[model samples]
Target chain A: MHASLVVSGLRKVYEGSGRRVEAVRDLTFTVDAGELVCLVGPSGCGKTTLLKCMGGLLTPTSGEVLVGGRRVSGPPPGMAFVFQEYGRSLFPWMRVGANVELPLKQKDLSKARRRELVADALESVGLADAAGAYPWQLSGGMQQRVAIARALAYEPEVLLMDEPFAAVDAQTRADLEDLVRRLWRQRGITILFVTHDIDEAVYLGERVLILSASPTVVQEQLKVDLPQERDQLRTRVAPRFAELRTHVYEQIQAAKRGEPS
Target chain B: MTDIPPEPTRPSAWGSLPLRVLFVFALPALLIAFWWLTSDGSTNVYWPPLRTILRTFPDVWTRARLRADLVPSLLRLLAGYASAAVVGVALGTVIGSYRKVRAVCEPVLEFLRAVPPPVLVPVIMLFAGIGDTMKIVVIASGCVWPILLNTVEGVRAVDSVMSETARSYGITGPARMRAVVLPSASPQIFAGLRQALSIGIILMVISEMFAASNGLGFTIVQFQRGFAIPDMWTGILVLGLLGFLLSVVFQLVERRVLGWYHGLRDSSRRSS
Candidate 1:
């Protein structure tokens, strides 16, 4: 069964060096079941911190994150997080298949079932042949794909990706974006993707959640009015796509200028 | 920029395997030839002829209970080194993972590490007696520091993201250590093990030298004291060969263990 996520009045304050730096303040948002939502923000705007809080990786100073209506205390069940640093995220010593199959070890699945899932996940990411290869043997984009395959193999109801495509080149980034959308549609998994790139957020998300600079809060929630059946070429060229991209772009620029939303 | 000439390509060292082997052996071969020629018939008290030493090697090694002595020394070395490796890696993981433990134990460990193994032979002899136990203890004490320190460094230096990934995947406790932590720290641990090997060898010799026991070190010292120059040279030569052989075997194991690390490093370097 798929799950949705809701974050309410979330605030995280880092108490270090005898000073408290407010990272995320009063950040409130929701992603409905089977919906793909992107949270876009400027650099150093506490997007990663907020995502960490939502994923239950970090304890918030106040407020709460609800996954499938349950408060998140530790890493929430039925939810997986894909970090931005793919190189650091994947185990270098593990082969591609082993890396993907790691999370499944926690599940009460038979060896055959686990193998099947690993194969399926690798095939989905187009890394079926690279299963025996180590992560370091592959290129950056291929490594990130292995990471995505890892998340996919977990068979989570919700996937939280933090700037997943940011480290790759332009061509690879575009290819990965399409792969994410395809996976989302095929599995009906709720996806909460975070990124600093305005175009990436616009290109991926059905609903783009704009976040302001620190102390961070939701600035705007812009809905993409593009067609359900979308392609990178036709969908991006649509006049509606251009309008939405501009709106998100202007919102980020204004947020950068410290304008109160 | 236009006037700058392109750099010339150096000749590849891998032109031929046989040629490369010959190149590496040329100096040692020449030295051996010189020694053989100079000392063939000379009757120096300390400086035994290479031929005399070579002739005595088979006699000492086969008939003079040298093989029996070799067994005890090898066994002690293996026992001490193995125990050290196990204890070092286990304790290192704990200290490295926890900050409080590291802070508490670091000073005492540092003090112990600073004391050379040879110096402690007398102290160990008094406590353990000049037996197999004492020799093993000396080797273990001497070799543990490198492994422990390297493991601590390796575990501490493990990328936080890797651990976080493991945690996110619900891999924690012993599973986390076995799957993520150990593998990540292996390259460094192997490096520490390499350092420990030579130290173990040195301690093996030192420990035997001090006590009333049978070992290569004891044999060497006995031969020297009795003015058996050829036999002493044979012992020295055998010890040197032993060191060389151990290192070669160790390198083969290390290569297998750290094959992934090397591959990753090479690929990244090539890309960069």
Candidate 2:
């Protein structure tokens, strides 16, 4: 159950083409082992860039991301990423089972063991029946599930998701948000999800990190202390939930106004 | 997901089926009909009515020398195309993965592809000898660029996010290419191969026609030299049929390889 991820004074900037744009500035955050933290930010606020830096997909200008107190020189050995564009994220040519099995192949697991893990992952995502199907053969929601299954099958200690459900319809997005909550609670995996949606962040995260406009720094941190199990309707109406959402919403507005909150 | 705009599927409703079928078949049918009308003892050039050409197919097919020529030509095409697939795909993969490799090779390949295969026919015939090897080289060299360029297109076209996703999983080095890059790039790769297949066929006939004393090209030239108009028409018809058949075969394979993508788009369209 030990799955803490620590990001310390991380700074990232894009410097090439003789035009430098700083993306993340002195971003410091820590997710306790098995905690779910949602990052809510404005567009171009570098939330995704921060996640990319944490996931080692982009190099940080300085500082480090540590998984279990070990510095991440590259993608952490036990980490996974789920992207927003599920259609582009999953390999269309691969069957659902094969796509899920891809990251597992890099593991030392035996073929039978890998099959078992893949089955478990797909079943967890309620996609066991689609093991033989290809990603393109599924709906956008289902394609995203295959992507989740791909990450799950990797047995990552930390899962980094960048707007995973943003492409789906409203109903599908709600359903996926619930699915993610279930996994977060059940597995206690360290989850860092980045999204522009405030309600989604309020709904799923145990903690929400509000980021400022581009050249992003942490605007505020709000702990979600609502009931552990959440339903979209009931939770959205909860008094504490409204209070927290309002606070995050105000912070975003302040960031937009370029005012300190 | 991705915001790529999809092409509309051809209407397959009952009313459209015949029209669609007619649309595809119309041009060739009209050409054949025109040939029939003009060559029916009415015109001197473009000799032989369509019927005379059809009648000559069997005689053309069964000739011992024709069998020898056709078999060798077909084998040469297969070998050349296969060689092109291997070398082109491999080189393209490496070039596609490395930016420096792509930059260095892209210009050279673009220039080479512009030069038609016929230009190389004489050079190959001189250096490799006027043998099967020379024709094979001619076809291979001519066809490889399409496959290579397509492979490069396919490989480069692989979504950057997918590669990032793979890298974020600690699936580095060769594993990343096989698992992520290759499958993602496959649709484009298949496109290149299909283009190469047709080019391979065209190069096959043209190379033989240029330098060799063998193959369908040789037969066509032999007919022309002997002033046998119908026989020459028969050779052209056989080549057309062969080209059409190769194209059909590749289409079938393309559908199979990209079946998932095709099915998904259809389903999405239906749902929408």
- Local distance difference test, per candidate? 0.89, 0.84
Tens digit per residue, CA lDDT, model 2, A1-261? 443888889999899989999888888888888899999988879887888788877779898899878888778887889999998778766788988888888888999999999999988988878888766666788889889988888988789899998889999999899999998888878899988999999999999999989788888888999899899899999999889988999999998876777
Q: How many residue pairs clash per model? A: 0, 0
Candidate 2 clashing pairs, residues 3+ apart or interchain: none
lDDT of 1: 0.89
> After best superposition, candidate 2 residue A9: deviation in angstroms?
1.2
Candidate 2 structure lDDT: 0.84
Model 2 - which docking category?
medium
Question: Which of the numbered candidates is closest to the native, going by highest lDDT?
Answer: 1
Error of 1 at B43 (Å): 3.3
